[model samples]
Target: MTFENSLAFAQEQDKLDPLAHYRQQFHHPVINGQQVLYFTGNSLGLQPKSARDYINSELDEWAKWGVEGHFHGKNPWVSYHEILTPASAELVGANESEVVCMNSLTTNLHLLFVSFYQPDGKRFKIISEAKMFPSDRYLLETQVRHHGFDPDEAIIEIAPREGEFLLREQDILAAIEEHKDELALVFFGGVNYFTGQLFDMKTLTEAAHKAGALAGFDLAHAAGNVPLHLHDWNVDFAAWCSYKYLNGSAGNVAGIFVHDRHGNNTDIKRFGGWWGHDKERRFLMENNFQPMTGAEGWQISNAPVMGMAILKASLDIFAEAGMPRLRKKSLKLTAYLEYIFNQVVAMFPDYQLQIITPTEPEKRGCQLSIKLIGSDKKFFEALTQAGVIADFREPDVIRLSPTPLYNSFEDVYRFGETLRNLLSQSHH
Candidate 1:
């Protein structure tokens, strides 16, 4: 499909878009009495309009029933997290039993590591990409130290070749093979946060298993941004935040995925709480911990009702729109954004604007991470002042994610126009 860098063309495309109506479901931020052009779904998604009502419903229940809300209220607080299971599972292509909404992303990863990252004497090393999100880097570093291993020794980070922005697939596969003997885990972000490079998780999972190691992912950027099949990929476990593409509000509760095999193994070591205990025996308060089967077994506490309620509002939208359709629109939306970037680059031939994200649709999500040569945060500030909302990583990269759910083709085109104007002003 051909893309045009014109308002008329963009509007035409928007008119033709099957998912364009979804944009109405979200509350776009109004800056200086105008709606800002949002391109940071990779960071924080636009809030669903229904989120307020979702929270109020939960609030009203609590106000009416007090302690009895656990059993008497609509969507009982005791089993509230259960309401999120089906949509969360569907979002990541997992069995209902394999997924659960609980805790924050980093917290869930730590909990999962306890059960999956069992690094014994010889097989104590973990393989992961370099420049992982800081939270994940800290998690891995501390997890290694907890087991009395030096991070430099136990963590093998596969960095890109000199001066490159993306990790090579061959290099990643080779690293797994090279450390097969000592590798206890092969963990990665499903999509690199900085570069927006989507890893081939299925192939990576296969390589890890072949090397006799467990495979996992922190799907912070991938969970709702791209299509995933955690169960079919045979991923040992995975976790993600709900705020980004999942459209849950800031600091919303996160979720995790455990393959049926692992989830069914109630004997698996986990930091458990009463919420994870068998429902029939939970209130009885037995001394011995009787864990529930499936992903619920990993729950460390009761549900965060308000957060889950807000998440439920967004998940309902996802259920109505479905991943397949969302993914379809996402591919086209990103392709159009890349086309606009190319047009902007052509307009400013001397600006040295470079897209660091992979051009291939299969290797990336909606994010296009651009490297602005000879520019600083000022350039990003200028874009923001001009009403473009995007993400800036330190040094030079600017990430523009045109999410399918809320962002439109016109948004991409307008961004191109804003970028071109900025470049023109810089030269003057």
Candidate 2:
């Protein structure tokens, strides 16, 4: 697939794109009365146009039915989370029973750790990637502390060698084996938030199991951005937020995946609430906690209907487009963005434009983290002022993700043009 830098080529690609219609489904951000080129779907996805209606319907249900909405609304408030199960499972490639829409990502990770991260005797160490998302770092640090272990001694962070930007798969596997004797859990982000490197979860999961450890993932950037097979990968547990590529609103209700093997174990230790108890006996108000037989058993409370409604609106879109189709378009879109980046670099021979994201399509998702050598936040502000919305990581990386669902090839082309112009202005 040869890519051209011309607008005609981008428009033609958009015309031929199977997912082109989805672009109209979202409400793109506008600044100064013009729609901005959105490249931060990896950070926060565009809101689905239907999201308002989804929420309104729930509001209407509340207005009309009040407390009766629990039993009589269009989607019963009592089982609102259930409406998200099928589509959410399909998005991450898991059985409906194994996936549940529940609390936020970090909260769910903490809950999952309670069940999977039991450190005992010599098996108190955990292996993970260095410089993971701050929330996750905090979660791991506090979780390790909660177990009365020094985080420095108990957590083995697999870092990139020397000056490299990405972690080599072999290095990760080797680290797992190095600490095999004491490794109790192998945790990682499905996609590194900074580098956008997609780890080979299947191989990593296998390595962890062989090392007699459980493997889990924080899929905050991977869940909807990449096609995942958590169940097939034999992951012990995983969690993801819905606000990014999943297109749920900001800080929306998140999701979790517990492989059938773990989800089926009713005896697993976890914080429980009535919603997670045996549904048939929920109203009996029994003294004992009879946990449900699947991922729902990990729930700590009942549904947040409003957030779930917004998420459902987006999930329905995912169900319609499907993950395979989305991935197909995503590969081409990202490749085109990469090509544009190369073209920009070639045009600016004096400027150092280094792409830190992995070049291999299989090793990355839609994001391309650009390292602007010798540049600063001013450049990012300039980009924003020019109507391009992207994410900036401190030190020197700018992350741009051209999501397949709403972003077109034209968006990528325009962004390239804007970048070239910015470079030209900076040079002058």
Encode model 2's per-residue lDDT on 1-428: one tens digit a residue. Answer: 88899999999999999899999999988899989999999999999999999999999999999999999968999899998999999888899999999989999999999999999789989999999999999999999999999999999999999989899889989888889999999999999999999999999999999999999999999988899988988999999999999999999999999999988999988888898999999989998999998899998898999999999999999999999999999999999999998998798899887999999999999999999898788888999999999989988899999999999999999999999999899899
Give the alpha-carbon lDDT of every model: 0.94, 0.94
Off by over 4 Å in 2: none
For every candidate structure, what is the RMSD over all alpha carbons to the true structure, in angstroms? Answer: 0.8, 0.8
Superposed Cα deviation of residue 151, candidate 1 (Å): 0.3
Off by over 4 Å in 1: none
Total clashes for model 1: 0
